[model samples]
Target: MTFTQLLRKENDDIFQAIFNHPFVDGIGKGNVPDKAIAHYIKADFEYLNAFMRIYGTAISKSAKREDIQFFNEQIRFVLNSEIHPHHNFCDHIGVGYEELQGYALPPTADHYMKHMMYHAHMGGLGETISALLPCPWTYWEIGQELMTKYEPSADHPFYQWISFYADESTGEITEEMRNRLDNIAEEASVEEQKHIKEAFRKSCQLELSFWEMAYTCEKWPGKEKVNS
Candidate 1:
């Protein structure tokens, strides 16, 4: 089995929990509170920004020219395609860029982004790639399963978001990235492979935290809520 496939199989419980999470199920039915969805989108925007930087750092750390090109293309997709339409969606739902940008990241958000960035900045190419793999792969897996259950309408609030992952094209991209990760694994030393797998597992756990965070609209610790 491919490393990613093994990771998925061994971590099936986490994936199931994430896929079954109310945050995801709600999106599938288009019934999540706008407040919750808005919070997720805002946090996701910041996460994507961090992803771009982490991806760029991966490109710099790569020894393979093809991997560099792949990173460049993926980064372009994030900037050119993934993010702008998201901004439009947020605009439609009353999430302003300034509001999103100025808001502090939730604890889960802060921890997850740091997790990816650590591998990107401090580890080798294998660690970087593995650290980054879970998000897109898990999203694609979720989208495919959700699409089987729900056909989104054009006016559906999250239609574009769902489509972004459900697109036939995205599966190819996810598979290609996974293959690259496997290749990186094949080339890695035993110690590096150990670190890479640990990174992948940690990212998967963080992904679950992300969904729960959105579900609860979790925020960092702060002043106690004032009773109205």
Candidate 2:
């Protein structure tokens, strides 16, 4: 089987678990409000920013010397070319530097995010890979499904957002994560099967609600700023 096929097969159980989730459920053809979906995506960007920071840290430290150089080069490009330009999803939803600095969400949520960063920084890439598996895959599944089922209207803000993270470029990140996953599976002496599943589920739930909350806030005037 090809890498994509193999990945799908091995990760089938985990994907099936998410297949029943509300976030993925709503992405199907339905009467869902576009604003609601957009909000959730915006909230997700906040989480993404936090997540990127953590993953960026791990990628920095855990990479081999050559990989570290490559990692730095990639990051420099991401920061300079993508984020610095403010041309990605964050800008689409008004999540500028000011907003991100003052954005409020659960402290516990921050902790959930921080754990991955800490793992990467301390335990190296393997532990970090285990810590960081759930969100992107879940988001990719949702994006792929939504794009397949519903055409985004011209007014849809999330079209750009979804496409930005769901493109082939994201494959670069996935490849890195999978490489780390291989090392993790090989190295870990005692892995917790239940926690791995639970962490993914909890992260998905958090992600779904993140979208739900953002949609709720976006529908209200003078409420563009989201706080916990």
Predicted model with the maximum lDDT: 1
Which ten contiguous residues of candidate 2 have the minimum total lDDT? 81-90
My TM-score estimates for the predictions, one after another, are 0.90, 0.60
lDDT of 1 by residue, 1-228 (tens): 887788778778888988899988877887777677777877888898899999899888878898889999999988787775466457666767567664567889999999999888889888898889888888888888777788877787777777878887778778888898888787788898889889999999999999889778898677855455
| Alpha-carbon lDDT, every model | 0.83, 0.52
Tens digits of lDDT, candidate 2, 1-228: 533344446666656555555544544434345444444444444655666576577656653775566455545544554443233334454454444443444444455566556555656555555566656565566556566656665455556545554566655666665665655555545454334434444554555444445435533335466355
RMSD of each: 3.2, 6.1
Per-model clash counts, in order, read 0, 3
- The superposed Cα distance between candidate 1 and the true structure at residue 55, in angstroms, equals 0.6
Stretches > 4 Å off in candidate 1: 84-92, 224-228
Model 2 clash pairs?
39-214, 39-215, 40-211
RMSD of 2: 6.1
